[model samples]
Every structure is written in structure tokens, then in C-alpha cells.
Target: MFGGTDDAVIGFSGTGGQSLRQQFVANYAAKTPYLGLLGLSRSPTTISLPDGYSRSFSSTLAGAWYQGAQGYPASLTFGGYDALRGNTDSVLTLPLGAEITRDIVVQITAIGISSVGDPATPVQNVAAFIDSVVPEMWLPQEVCKVFKDAFDLEWNDDLGLYLVSDSQHEELLSQNATVSLSLESQGSTVTIDLPYEAFYQPITYPLADILDGTVLHYFPLRIAANDTQYMLGSVFLQEAYLAVDYHRREFYLSQAQFPGNENEYRIVTVHPPGWSHGLSTGAIVGIAVGAFALVVIACGLLWWFKYRPRSKKRASRLSAKSTEQDRDVFGYYGREKDGGEETYEKRELDTAEPGMRGSIASRCELPSPPLPQYSPGSPERDWPKDRGSIDMVEMGDYLTARRVPVQSPVELSADSEHERRPPPVEIA
Candidate 1:
């Protein structure tokens, strides 16, 4: 049989059944949470029981099991689990409080093994590996001898394994034989005791070589021929919870617990190192939207400033040019007597005629005879032959006299008292 996680288990049956019929069986069980973190790193690893309770992984480091150069068993802290409260069997705990090292080495010293009623002794320092995939303990051939002698077991040369009678198996179960390990921590010694049940297993043989009329039974134990390595497999793990901390280079082993309810749980946040707080998706989206809106607003304001009309500037420039025209060409300072309000308003150029300034200067220098004032329906009088154009400002009493009524358009001389003076120009 091979079993660890439900996802990876295979079982086989051999020659023991009636008619020697062969069959293969497979099954799946609940999804084990710890199995999901296998071969993965930097994940929020956790494991929970049937109850709602859960325990999160304790570090920011990734949990990679059985797939790296530094593979370790999933172990809990040694004293983290509660004690076995109601069990009748005597259990032992050996605390291996070695300082954490870079390499997460999980080793326990197996001192010795014995059968029913035999006094357990300490073997030399024996290293063992904790592997859950292994069905049972794998002991060295020499260490297997100790168990064989203590139980008075027979060895079969053909099978190269120990053979236990049905009576011996029953007696061993009644006596509850044990194996021992010695751990040294801080100059003090701790011992771990394993009962006979921890090593019990059922073995099967192939059906191809069954003899006629011969009955065959299953044997569980197997010995390592080279005596070089010993393994503590799932049998031990079923009774213990192992937690490994790669960052701290340490591990803990405690007796497993089955909480009836999920109320009791410790939530741990396991994130990558240097990770504290980060912006959420909503916050990032909000900031992006705000930035885009601001950009659009800025572009609108820039376009308005660049292309909008400048009516005030055009008005000011036209007023300044009108004042310049009044000072340079017409030079008019006419007085008005209407409604007790004295007003002087400069008009813009009606026509842009060249040499008009010289003609006005010549007409102002000499006085001519006064012309007759005509009524609305009077016959037309003969006009003077010298000046061909009329002064639009002085036509029909439109331009008020400067405190004097002139008879003709040419009556206003350069030295005449009736000449109008230019109005004052307002700067700015």
C-alpha cells in the first residue's frame, strides 16, 4: 500500500484471498490544504481540520515541500499542540532544541527498539528521516535483529524478512512493545517513546507463486538490508503534527489535535517580506480617472485663452486713434450750449484723404467774403470759384462757433479771433 495525500495513493492486493483472485483498488478523500502548498513558494499556506478552525503558515517565506534541494516535512512547533488528554498509552516527547541553521535538518536520534516485556536500551546515535509517504518504519538489518530477538521472531531465508506467528502478533499487541530515541538539547537529555502499534503493518505477496494447498498470510515489517538508514513514516505523522519554518531554520513537532468546533483559530498573515500596505484596485482607478479629468479641464482653459475675442483691446485702440485725429487734423474746440452739459466727443475719420492737412492750413491763413445764408426752398446762389470742397464740420450751423458766428467757410483765418482751438487730448 502507498498513501500520503488523497490525491496520490495507490493500493494493491495479492495472493491471500479465496480463489487467488487479483484486484486493484483506488480511492480519493478530502482535499488536504497542506498538499496545495507543496512545491509552491510565497503562498498563504494553511491547514484546517473538519471544524471551521484553521492555522495559517507562520512566515513570509514560501512553503515548498518535497520538491527542492532543501526539502523538509511540514512540521509544527514542538509544544504548540495540546497534550494527549484521554489516551491510556504512555507517550514520550524528546525536545530537539538545536539552534536554527541555514540547512533545515530534521533528525532524531533513535536509541533502540524492544519487544513485549523487554527492557529498552539506548543504541548508538542513529539518524532517522521523517517521511509521510513511507508506510511504516524502515530499520537497519542489525536493528531489526534487536526487534527479532526481543520478540523471538523467525527469519525466512527465502523471503529475507522476519516472520511473526499469529499468537506472537497477538501477544505483542497485548504487551505494547516500544522503540526509544534519545535527543540532546542544551546539555540535557530527552527521550521519545514509540509503541508497538506505530510499527505494525500488513504486507502482501504476489499470487503467481502460491503453492497448492498451502495457506499464506500477510507480513507487515520490512528491514533495510544495508542497515544504513531508518525512516519514520506516516505511522508517526498520524500521531504528530510537524511544522517547519524555513526562514528561522527550525521546526516543531506536537501531538495532533482534532478540535470539535471551528471557533478556536489563530489567523496569521503570510506575505512576502517587505510587503506592508498597498493601494487597492479601486483607489488606483479613482486616481487615474481624476488625472484624466484634470487634463481635460486644463486643455479647455488653454483653448479658451488662446482663441477668445479681445473686444476691450480693440475699443481702447479705437478711442486712442480718434483722439490723435482730433489733435492732428480738425483741431476743433467748438462749444455746445444744450441742457447745461458741456460735451466734447472726437469722431473717427470718414475718409482717409491725403494732403487734407495742407488744404486746411491754407484755408485758415486768409479770409474770404461772406456768403448768403439760404433758406430751405430758396434759389441756389452762385458758389465761389476758389475752394471746390465744403467743410462738413461747419455745414448748416452743425459745428457750433467758438463764441463767434462766421459769415463764410473761409472767414476763419490763422489770426482771426473766431478760429476754433483744438480740444485737449486725454492720455490713456
Candidate 2:
């Protein structure tokens, strides 16, 4: 089937398998908050304008932002199409306009249609809290979709080759064209071709390079649509070179070339019309996995960065701990420690001069150390004269010594020959 007519059957797909989100869900994979959007690109960095931009649902995207124009500021200029159903690159960098990307959060202060009220004239600071909503995907709006028969779906713009379900009611459509839908059902192929493409270019700066988070803005639509009249997008707009600037309320666009070796990302594109992602499942999956991996890897690297310093600091503590102590109380010699060390009393010798009273007699020669005396016949009898330390009287010249010569005074005398032990004497 080619173009559809008013007679073409128009009904919602109520069949169980007909649910729109069914095949797109990842039943076997780990679930993510925005996994559905991952069908566009692997993650945030790879995501570009319009479509790709929307897929980034990271924390950096928090607060308000804006992307593709479902609702837009009235200040922008809408650029018409180059041709019907063809590619037209919006000159974003030339400052002629801004090509919107996804992942942009717009504070949607208003949503109105071309035929009616303007929402941007709120007369105050436009606020956010979802002032309006992007219409849901499922709706029987005035969209150019395939139909089974001529119903409300039939349009004068439709190419006339495709017939509706019933032959009774013929529908009007454009001539010499073909309309098509990949929708395969009822053993019939239906399609339509349209000669219409349009783009909007608003004067913008290069601020829209990245997008994410809640978007807040005042906007009026070029055409108003019901809750069901939402646009379907592919990943191209997101993965393409793009920018968004809500501070200035402007969008920037450009052709993002793939980085040869550097980490710079590549732009996404679409080969056919009405493709939300790429034509093949492989393309869709590749984009999704790539983006997802990039985010996960980035997050992992950040954690490693933060935790790495902590570990290094702890390791350095081991070196510092050793120096903090004078020595291990038990020692660290790798062998059994010997017996307790002999304790010595700290005796402070009076290096200070003792004055005249402290001086020893010149004849005493600092009092020659008395020798030990003993009877040779017995070992115990040989009394040892332990060394005596001197304690002097504060005002007296004589030093006090507690000592007894091991030998008798007679031993000092030349006549006394008996090996004798003298009683210990305390010389004061």
C-alpha cells in the first residue's frame, strides 16, 4: 500500500503484542532508570542533539534544562524544510540558528499552539514544575501514519496509491507519490510519502554543548497538539554535534565529527525518515551499550580517584608509625629477648666546684682507693672492698666515705705479717 485515504481504517492497536513499548523493553538485562532512552546511545557523552541528547539521564543533568523543541520560546525563528522528506543540516555554528539536542532540560513554562494563545507571555519569571508536557506517543492525532481504512486518518496530502480497508469510501491524497509504513499487519503493506520537512533556527551561542536535568522555560508551539501528538525521534539528533543554552535560552548546533583518537565523540545520523533510532537493531544496541559503558566507566573512575588517595594515605601511616615510638617496648629483633637489663641508678655527679671545703687534701691525692685484704687460706675470708662513693658535708672540707680497708691497719705497718682481715670501718 502507498498513500492512505480518508477511507483507510484508523484504529488503535489493542492487541496484546501491539503495545508500543513491548519489544523495546530489556527483559534480560539489568534495569536502569532511563534504560528505555539508552536505545539511542551508549550513555551521556556520546549522546548529541535532539535524540541523543535526551538519552543522558545523569546527575549532572539535574536541575532544569532544554533540548529538542516540543515546546519552545517564541523568540526563535522556525526555518522551513529544504525539501520534502530529506536531510537538511541546520547551520547552528553559523549562529543562524540552533539545532536542538536531547538531554536538554527546558523549564516548560508554557505550551500552546500556533492557532491560539501564547504561553510565553506569562508576564513574570517563567517557572518550572512541568508547566506543560510533551504529548504521549500513543494518540490518534493529525499525524501522517498508516491506516487500515479511510477514517479520520485519511488526508489530502497522502499519496494516492495505497487503498484503505473498504473500497466504498475513497479518500483524497496527493498524486504521483508513495506513502509507506513499516507496519506489517493483516497481510497488507501500507506506506505514504510526504514532501515536507522543516527546521527552526534561533540565534544562539555555543552554550548548548551539553544537556541534562529538569528543564524549565516559557514556550509556545508552532502547532498545538493533544496529549497523543508527540514526535518520534531517532538517535541522530542526540549523537550529532550539538549544544544547548538555557541561561541565554538559546540552542547551538554543529556537525560533530567523530574524534579519530582523542576522546571526542561522534555524531549520530539517520538514513531514512521517521526513524527514532537507526534502521537496524544492531545500530540501536551498539549505541545503547556504548553510552551505558561510558557512564559506568566514568563513574568507576571517579570512585577510584576519590578512594585511591585514601588508600595511599593509610599506607603512609605504616611508615610514620615506626618513627613515632622510641623503640618497641619488647623490641623487634626476631629472636627471644635476653634477661631483664640491669638497672642503674641515675647518680648526678656534682660537676659544679664545691668551693674550698670540697677540695680533697693535697696529700690525700684524692684518697687513693683502699685495696682489698684477705687471708689466703680461705676464699670467703678474702673480703672484697666494694667501691665507696663520697658524700661530702655541705660546709666541711672532709668528705664522708662508708668504707673499711679489706686489710688491717697493721698490714700497713711493716711489722704485721699475719694475713688479717680488718673489721669494716665507717669513716665519717
lDDT of 1 at 234: 62
Q: How many residue pairs collide in each prediction?
A: 14, 68
Specify the poorest-scoring 10-residue window by lDDT in model 1.
Answer: 8-17
111-204: candidate 2 lDDT, tens digit per residue: 2222122221211122111111221112122232312121222232332212222222222222222211121122432121211011112212
- Which ranges in model 1 have alpha carbons more than 4 Å from their true place? 1-119, 184-190, 205-221, 225-228, 255-428
**What is the lDDT, from 0 to 100, of the residue 248 in candidate 2?**
41
Give candidate 2 regions above 4 Å deviation: 1-90, 93-229, 232-240, 254-428
Q: What value does the lDDT take at residue 310 in candidate 1?
A: 61
Mind sharing the TM-score for model 1?
0.37
